[model samples]
Target: MKKSTRILCNGALATAVIAGLSAFASGYLTGAAPWPASGLTALATANGPVAGAPSVRKTLLGSAPAQARFDRIIVRYQDAAQTRSRPASVLGAVNAAATRAGLTGSRALAGHGASVLDVQHVRRLATGADVLRLSRGLDRGETDRLLAELRADPAVKYAQPDYLKQRLDFVPDDPRFDLQWHYTHPSAGIDAPAAWDTSHGDGVVVAVLDTGYLDHADLNANIVAGYDFIHDPDVGGDGDGRDADAHDPGDWVGGNPSSFHGTHVAGTVAALTNNGVGVAGVAFAAKVQPVRVLGHGGGYTSDIADAIVWASGGHVDGVPDNADPAEVINLSLGGSGSCSQDPVTQEAIDGAVARGVTVVVAAGNDNADAGFFSPASCKGVITVGASGIDGARSWFSNYGATVAVTAPGGNATSGSDPDDRWIWSLGNAGTQAPLPSPEGDRLMGMIGTSMASPHVAGVVALMQAAATEAGRPPLTPAQVKALLRGTVKPFTVVPPASKPQGPGIVDAAAAVHAATQEIPVDQGELLSNRVAIAGQTGAAGDARLFKIVVPAGMRSLNLRSYGGSGDVSIYIAYERVATPTLFDRKSAKPGTGEAVVITQPAAGTYYLSVVGESAFSGVSVLGVYQ
Candidate 1:
């Protein structure tokens, strides 16, 4: 995030709420101020203690709806008056302290500035090295001990976990899926390419932002059209507009620290293979467009916001717009927060949602709750949290009511979910000679939801592919989200597990079939939110996508996955990038299960793409608004 934060929500202006109340009672009484626990509730944080979910038979949706009420405690180097001149010393200091204090995770670097080496915004102390955003930990003893330690340390400027806040809604796991993936890969469930020959994400064009693509034999044909977004960072590359794709090293060499993420993300969405060697993507036929935004010192918030608009086929002053519109946009990066909305962040997301595009975002690696990040907490876009193949929340994933559906985004101990981990994909050699004969082929092994997100995107492409071929209008982002949400299956993970929700594992076979279908909500189906609720109740292949009819008089809908106890917490959905946004939205009821509010111009048929909280079951009710 840039230092000049604006146009989004609140706490985003400056990541500076971390220095409050680490002092003692006397210290608090003297110089410290009172905490606004009540107001803070507006921006809530985590609830399951730390690094886990609640223990229950059915996972409940939304984190009790209270995480949004907490005040956000942001922390950053005061010296960072401007993002450009943030100062490296501050980042160095923070990293030194973090390492000394024993905070383990990705090591920090002087990527953003000088005086401000690095900054971290957290929802709970469950993760991070130095700074944190902790609300009152239910355990008084634990809270007190942590407070004492923070105050005792001189380097620790100040601490306050209970006062500030932020809000994270529904989000999810991987990228859009590949089209042809359903074929060959049994997980996708399709027996052969012919099974999907009638349709696949062929009509869908997905843009992959990263280093220059290899233009390999299998991949060359699938690429619809692309441009180089990478302007080259000093650390690597010829800084050329489109250097002939060459030998890129590391799962990330040549590609700036920023570009590497894009490549990793691409493989997850569309790697190639059916003809022979390597892994298969969710939607192999979907077009892959590469956009390079993260080239140097991370990227500026402005560039990303622009990318969002561009990715959706919106015009950008200088950059070439994504000629073809995408139904979904995926984001896997963010700054800290305690559930507080950043105006700057919101605007960008709002702009995207305003269009018909559905945005998919990462819930965060904070491993605490969805109330931890900025844009992911936005109300509209789909906010995704990571999970293990075992159906448990990844130890590194942030869970809360905001989370939509969970996908296999490898964990801290492992990488992508075992089912998809080390899965082969086309290689991205930054800029080196081709394979076997300088112009040959090879594969790359990578991880992270950055890698997983494309899988989801690929699925979206196939859904679009089916819609196009079947003589139906292409689905809006909302419709796609609804389809994917209600289709997820339940997988279980017990204690000693790092993730809160186990894999719940995605079923590509199921999703591909669902994509081939076009559930038409005719005139008769319109005006009411009552779809043989009982008969319409069954999660398809995605686990996250479910089917429900809008009941009459019910304007709003609420789907919760309630866990029986604290020892075991299942999730329904991970987060929502924004509000009232989706691939499709029929008449929905006013939330709170009270009254119903209809949004469709007139009473008509509508379908909700199911977004899971943890592992939902039981009365997944849809209310109609009056």
Candidate 2:
């Protein structure tokens, strides 16, 4: 079946607007080393069955002030077991049950759980259950009614509308950089107007988890407070407002500041901008909370888990409610390993999400398939990959089903000139200037998707701001994700064709503008990516590629635009010439946004007409892989 295509914000909107956390590229046009030699090749065109199915169970709400309580409340529920309706009706049934018990909403919160319930509207307000806010419209007694019903319904599992949530990262938009290319991707470095028409996300917080950040002039203002999760317990911080850990402050030096990756990532999210010095970050302004988890070399998964819990209001044994709790957690580090559904990793990530904090992760830089990365492959979290200057794959960014989207990480390390590199961010001011000599200043432009993830986190902040400006309605995680995806400026050419697959480069202007589009708009879906003779019109946006799952025995096909205004003359041939192929030509009158469809006469590996038209939109669909 043909699907409607979704268009997002044009690059015009990203002209420097003020807002919160933001984050989000690729390579050149050579031969298709990663893609098929022919322009149209087959790939796993359709989305496979979703892998993980994590459930959302809420007891306490996040916005309930640091004092509300509850044991558990199911976000989504049904009454299959009870053979009846859900919690609402269950409440009525339970009230009947409660009346039988001679009590109204007879129940009590279990332990110290009352201190953690809030988050009434969760669309983009909360990630999971950390901040559980009961429906404000519902009365206290209504809880009793539902409880009575839930406890009675044998079929009813649970029922709770997901609360809204807003998550982001720390970044600095210093405007000063050795080089900066605002390639429309927020992750490449947030771009928009200097001020907002309205303040959408004023009261939200984001936790940056990466290298320990250095104290820089650009970042001093955005920080709320943070902690060091680096392994060495001996390495305590200066305890002063600064995150100077007990360890000696030095460059990657004698091998030290590797831990500061956290700090760098933080700067990219909420770095103080317009100060006339360094670079500016995606989120023009956002409250950043630093949570250091990697240090001196690398860190163990255990410390990272604890850090996640602490970032949220959840207690870690005795580490009081973190000095700064986060509404969103930024995880820009990940290993090139398969996602092991291990309890620990899963729990930690799940716990963070449970608390209404959106978790954003990096897709890794191994240049391998996405299935090879953890956390990125983890279910629910926003997994982002890196692209380059020209909006091409970074040659090294991992790709696959798990990847949600691509951003400009800038391929500083990938051999592409300025064309491929990361969004410019901030470097730290050495604690004690380099003894004024050989050391010089430690801060320098670093590269990697590691550098790009925070940009998206910052974008999330902007989205939150957009919602706030619209009034504090529930902004669910699903909705936030949808907005992010739908807002993307679809790339006509695949990411510079470095990696095998790419969601295409991100466009911050497109993303923020995407927020302005209708809520339920379709983001467009692909049926397949395989082609036989694969080809594109010698022109720019022309040529159509497709995937056709060949049923059985079939070959030779005739295809044409389904709903064309008039008889169009397009071509059907092979690409790299030299051999027999199909679908390669120009068109006389492709018709104005005419509906096009290419079908196989029978079914087999083949390619069809390549009508040179501009743009990847129009109902006209392409097919292959058959």
Candidate 3:
């Protein structure tokens, strides 16, 4: 991460919010503050937080919705079984409810004027019961009244306005995609080009919770409708706070105008690709939901927590239910606190995971252990650290046991070449020299765990899309984390101080490949001259079986075994049907390393099985034929 030499304190901005918006501005400074310098290295002090960096302000404008439209409602019967059996009964019930709500109006028949109840069209939801579209125009009050009347029906399950969902097409013609080394570079980047061959992330929505977004030619089309959770106008910078518009105005402090951090993060996840204009996105076809929680100086933990719930399709007071909930949530911000001491953030993450939303958080840029951070230390999140072009830990990345994976966050260390080390993404020209108004979009380079996290999120989008295409169930957050850890490419060189960099740098190609693989048979086994398998036992008496073929002219079979943090035993049987006992070649090693070799004798199929000495033990086995 590159640290700026200049740092300024915006006392006036902090004082203004402290006076007028105490509730929203609590526990945080007003201006864009950088993370405090650490003792790790002199260059470590150069990088600040990856968000809201010092830059000139740019007046990027976005158009607002013309008028609110309320002309439809989604209705599902209370008893799905009954509704499926008698569809007509539910339709009749809806008509009766509309009539009782005084919304009846009809056309004349045969030159005679007569009134009739309005019934425009009824459509069935793919998974639910039905959604009714009323006549074109209706006010909020009228729609609410009609919904209330429908809810009065005992048979009606749920009745709410069918909110408008706009599709922003994300197709960029940006020509700078070729310069994005982080996508295709061999040693320094996640192999995005190879992963793209399998999936382009269609049918997946990723929620980006950051300092909101900007309207850029390269990014607008792929954005979905999202909400602003910044409750203070000072921090929000949009004059008013916490409204429907999620467009970022600017988060300028004294020294830093604004990082446009949210926009950069969004572009990394799903920027417009192959439109002949800008850089390509990791998941080019995935939609992004920009949920604003950070603005102005910085955001509060409370507002960020609420955004998580709303983004995951959970209800919050005074906030409308999300029409397009995300399958993946990316949070690129963090504060200095342990998750164990921060239950508010932890609970929100827990809730999001319970609802099947995979949350990916940055491991922070503090050059310290991530265990001291809030969301990164949270149990269920896929905490990510940053690596550089050389695939070494970024100078400013946080590390610890909690980190699940690492990605290319770029390095701006002293003497590091910018062309080879920087992560380039969409940004405002104002972030460069000579502060200007009305910021025009440009490409900028940055380095931090903040940058590394979105790579994982984008790869998750690819995995989810592939899983859907393969007609398989979506992976749970735990499963997603497992796939990421299990498939990472080992580091070419071990990191300094033996820091736990998870399994290795995240491998997008391997993750997607694992997600889309066909479900394995219960007793299926891998075949090769040498085979290695790693797994964990579920409960007591749980056993995993593998079959190996010993050809007629085979020389010898060799086996080695190891257990992780628990007791496990390996058994080999030459017979076709009988379960092997201790009488057979059983190696019940006390721990870790155990080995057994069979002489060149038999030539048929043999079974190798692993059984846990106790519940939940981890095991690894190696089979070799010579």
Candidate 4:
């Protein structure tokens, strides 16, 4: 077995009455506010007591309905109206729509000032749409009615609610090598050691769309230039709107210092490693681009959408172009709502994916179905859930079919021994500012689906780096997500009967190893007849590609692999080589009895691959078509 190179380590913006909002914010501050911590009883610091706090499980675990109210609406006018019409005329058209909806008339918003109107323009979006803030917040029904009326206008292209998104975070406790068990634990860990031998994500850039970065010795070296996208000064807490500085001035809404949430998150993605320093990060050698979107309270949907596009190297109207485009974008924040309810945010995610960026998001900390969360439920993104030391779904992790995979997000509530269950990463000791001694306050232990999302993001960086090092083109977002789901480690503990937490916990080593292997076109065997071909895969991550040409007018095509001693999976695709990540159909049942049947099959060459989910021998592959 390959050995690890370095020392071990472990470790919404939105509103609505988010159950754990206060606890999440104050719990992670300088001292213990309310959340649980290590075995140590309350340890007092300059700020206050910082340990042995009571668990907010009841408050944190329950699902809170997303705020079903909106104070703004986004609209995109038809081409001529948006580009050619006078500002007054556009305002008139919008007011006309508002009148139809039984709302008051409105005025055009100034270039850099506020306005008094029932529906006043807020700003333009990166996608060329316009945002208009209402005089007051509207209930769900009222917002829906307003949107309908706006969309009914002849000059309107589309109209959507401008919802708010909150960070999907929770406060964790304790910091030490033992507490970092999520990195190397036999059953619960991600197996980062084996992956480190192959790739430390040296050349990849991962964009963290969360609170801005706080300077920390362990993470500063791995952080690249980032941008602050928060436009509301009240939320920014930086006394200004959007600017070039991504420095976190603190996001404390109360008497405590900031939570240093982004710093903790960034550390997990790419903190400096093997430097005889604090804690090790998942993709320690990768560069983290901090894209600040969430701040005090949370952030607006429009700012987040713009950040998503800009982080992936797309153009945002006012922001400068990203010099370092991210291969992976981690969204550790979200709001309570279905993806369909927020088309603007979904559109941004869609655009980012189309640009070939692997978007990873938290399934949410709500124990309910992940499909209820924005971005988590959005299409073309890898939604992740949290797992615990026992290898079961974390108590607070959102579950459902939408979750792509699980990772160690820690469960401090597991039994009484909660000391080693939380994830330890870089953090700050100062409540509102950096301490004089950087190293003293550089470590933090935290848990949440927020933490879980970054683990997958880091793994993606490693995979992309490994593939590039192997001389392969970068994997597309779909391909990356496919590999992650296909290579997950099966859960050791059975999850709740109804809530499915994806295939299993993420296996970093398995994912990276798979990313490094590619099948050559010339190596594929051609199936000339219906005779069963016997083959074997030497070990897990090994695969055998095959090609079969189906004649025109084929009514059906069937393929199967059976009689294997160990586990194997079958993947089939038309006209292209099939791998786990790039397959049209796949069957990965236990052992090796797998089959794929296609009705009204397309007339073309079919590619089939038998992959070893574990070492397998004496596997027989047969294909039949009529």
Candidate 5:
């Protein structure tokens, strides 16, 4: 059946841009070992599922706050201060800028931590940048003028207001978060809450190209105007052909009811989250554009192709230009046949990729090779397979080389306890048409590869949004696919299917953090041998790496990391990076602190790595040698 590819609805699964938190909040990715030759590996962990701890829920509404005032500014000079006594040249430039901006009482204080400034030294960065504080917070205009004056000085390389940073380790107040084991499970889940600390997919838009969306309070707020691309009136189910209205009229046929498949998928990608309502979406702050292509007896390849182009900002002959074009497109619907045999669909995917849109598609549910599916077999698109709560490939998901990654798509076997294994999201109760009353709004648990595709799409949106918030350019389609394939979480068990299920499960926190550019490590800063640096890492399964060199005369070396919330494991490797699975010296305890000492240590480069057993913060990595 070419119809939206028969997703099992009976209790089965399916499927941030802000001033991002510091790069360390999610941890920076260092060059690491490549995926195993077989491509996919099972995650070998001793941890079990986490029990739910539902908290008091609250919602925030109203317009956003006004522009912020600044009382501190970080100024970097062309030269470093060799001595602690504030350099005379640096003092003169600061005084000059203060005077030019009509400010008084400017003097350089001792460099350290936070302190009020008439004009004073805050602290010196490893790169020799100076943090300066003002007497009081200045309004936007005054701060701008002050920055301009500071930048005008020949000695000043750069100057900008020091923005206050909030903790990025956010836990949403959504009541349903407790029910979402697919997000909270330490070994099997995606670790989305910790990633939320970095970004909320703020400005990115994801187009859900499938059956049209239905009206539901949980999803309506994040939805934008989308076009109906069902060319045939019979297929559309509506009285007319393609139109701007993307509302689902239902696609019931005899005994089967309307799947409301697209609504569920869109909800997974981006439902109104943290609203103290029903469920939370992966990229809740992102907008979902509903481009209806599947309907009645299923949609034509031609219709799906045109919808892809238009949603990605390309123009169709009679369709209007998409104003809020999507940065990501989720096709939770697919058909049989190789991509080469479907030239139009392949061409459309190519065009979308050229336009810089990341295309994500389902790897079908035929329990066969994904290489035989249309969009999944198509090049330039991310083919997503389905996995259950156990982190194994879902029983019905398509597999093989073409599948890029697996996501939580739920599994409801006939006699097994599938209640906890289903993917939960927004849905409607109407069997064949739009249900009347708010009572029609529903929350459902479904299982299928159709459900898994949106999970990857949501992660892509988070990656793009985090990149933008971090002041980095959006990743190209190729880069997005690579990032996803590179940052996946290993399945807990190998798939029993004959073929492999691509790389592994998609990890939201890992992928989002990896999307940000890593800050270059400076070996020069570690010459003192006795230094402590503050660092952080996202949810369990996320990791950070640090490199240090030992001098020849050192008698002993101590490496310690302490004072962090949440559990973490530390690993030490000689001359190379270490991971949870590959490390020389290791500490895999339950606490936040880990210590390892080396007596008569060899003189060479050493790698210290911290792998999170859970989200951690305020950790101090100390290195000392005597």
Candidate 6:
């Protein structure tokens, strides 16, 4: 008999076995890494099994799953060395292969041209790959057959179904704008309203990865066309699988109503502001790209990863290239495990950052160390923790060395009865339990790093906009993180007091101000007898090279770097070079400092190079030689 695996549901035998085993063990709860046993239990109660279960939770509307729509496949050519310059040839090859594969009426066009293959659109990915969408819709079996035939072609690389993704927040003013204490509060908020004067994130695009969104009066104007990434119809809940439509159906699971999490996060980042209607957003002018990843039962890591790549204009097997790529990507969801250990998620993040997209993630809500959570712990990401009204850490916000900064997530510890203490944003009138309500849109309060992350993401949008307006290039992820850390408001008291919190509360005004200022690059100078210099690495991949002459009798050379906000490495070569590749000696440690000692120095002309590590920037470097 062939062994088969099925998704575990809350009422399934696997969940029953786990629950039964929980009774025999006291520390069973403690073994959960990212989530506490209570968190897992709550998740189980809200949807189903905490493990591998598809979301059975219903949203406020409690709609039935829609049928899969749009039968399309993504195909790549076999030549690995293909360049983006040859779009015509790529199209010709794909069209030819489609014809041979019996994909009747197939024709390939470049740059969104009409093709006989019903090629709805053709997107050239950053990887120099092409993604084509078929005009005809097919069932899963038919799509699989087409994909197999296309893959068998010599010119074809790989083909697969164009999987769908779910859409997945903020503060803006229509009426209850003042209720968002997380925006205007001096110590407890991100100081968004004040920063709005300098910049409102104009011309910036932020990708929100979460459950698909709803048609809200306040958010519709700001939402651009986004793709649904949900492939499984059961989990998609939108009645159909992946399509160009990014509208949120409902993700209510178990008995929980739709959280409208993506809408809430988008509002906080760039909802219409000063409209005298709802509430004020952090960056009111920024555009939001809703890439749905989570749906019923929650989303899979695989879907989430694909959304990341697509949102950043990278290629997915069957997805069209994102026309409006995001300058910043906000991820409010995460699971147990270190990002270093999870290659799939880490690679997506790295690829985004490589394309100059700043990634902001939420620390888990377990009130534990964030180092145990993924994406938050991922290198090159801006991990955010949450703070409450008292200017202290939220009781439930995760803390640890991995946290880059803290923002208002809100605290209901005082009580949820009063709306003042919680972080308020636009929401559907339906409650978590999903009740019939006459009211349409309303101000809802929530607490968690999920709520906190959008504040930072919004502020980042402001900074990026300000930088662009100043006629400066877009800031790299490393520079953004550095500026955020440099401008933070110091914590009154450490949240856990055991583990260190982030540098301080994120201050949008200060960050915008910093972005407007000019950054000076220092050039090192050589002394008469010895070479002593001080400099800084401005951004990731930045290399600061300086020339130093080994004195006549010098037999050894010592070089070192110290006192900087980010990790820096030292490289030295015997010849003048534009890059650091020709290094004779180098030192790359995992901290703010580095050192390299060369024994038998034969110096004609030695070049000292300082490079920034992943997302490492604005770190001061001091070079001393004896």
RMSD for each model, in Å, please? Answer: 18.5, 20.7, 17.6, 9.7, 24.4, 14.6
The sequence of per-residue lDDT tens digits that candidate 5 reaches over residues 1-626 is: 11111111111222210000000110000001111111110111113112342222221111112225666666666664334225455556666776677554333222212333366665543234555656766776767777889878666656665432110011111112124577667767777776777878898899998888988887888999999987668768898998999998976544334567788789888887655455678888999999998776456556677788898998777678899999999987665555644455666787888899999988876677777667777767888888887888887677876777888877655312434566767766555686753567766545667778888899999999999888888898867876887788888998754567766888888999988975333322242467788755333334567767887878898887888576778898887666566778988788678988989989997788876654455677778888
The alpha-carbon lDDT assigned to residue 421 of candidate 2 equals 47
Query: What TM-score does model 2 achieve against the real structure?
Result: 0.51
Model 1: per-residue Cα lDDT over 1-626, one tens digit each: 11211111112212211100010000000111221221000110112111232221211112221222222232232223324112253344434444454332333223212222234432111111123322222133333333444445454434333321111111111111122222233332223243244445675667654433555554666655555433224412445533323223222223211123444455456555353423455566676666544332222233344456666776654455556766666665554553232433454555666676767666665556454565556646566655544445555566654555666554424211232322234543222332342243333333344444555666666667777776777676656666666665554553243233322434444555666676654212121333323212111111223323433454445432222211111122112211223332232222212122334323333333333222222323343333
Best by lDDT: 4
Please list the C-alpha lDDT of all candidates, in the order they appear: 0.40, 0.45, 0.64, 0.74, 0.66, 0.62
Candidate rank order under lDDT:
4, 5, 3, 6, 2, 1
User: Which parts of model 3 have CA positions greater than 4 angstroms off?
Assistant: 1-178, 414-416, 431-439, 519-626
Index of the highest-TM-score prediction: 4
Candidate 6 lDDT over 290-351, as tens digits, reads 88877765565556767889998888766788999999999987765555434456667779
- How high a TM-score does candidate 6 get? 0.65
For 192-311, candidate 3 gives per-residue lDDT tens digits of 877887888998999999877887777888999999987657767788877888877765554334566788889999987765445567898999999988765566555676788899
Off by over 4 Å in 6: 1-178, 414-417, 431-439, 523-553, 559-595, 600-624
lDDT of model 1 at position 130: 21
Summed backbone clashes in each candidate are: 213, 144, 20, 13, 12, 53
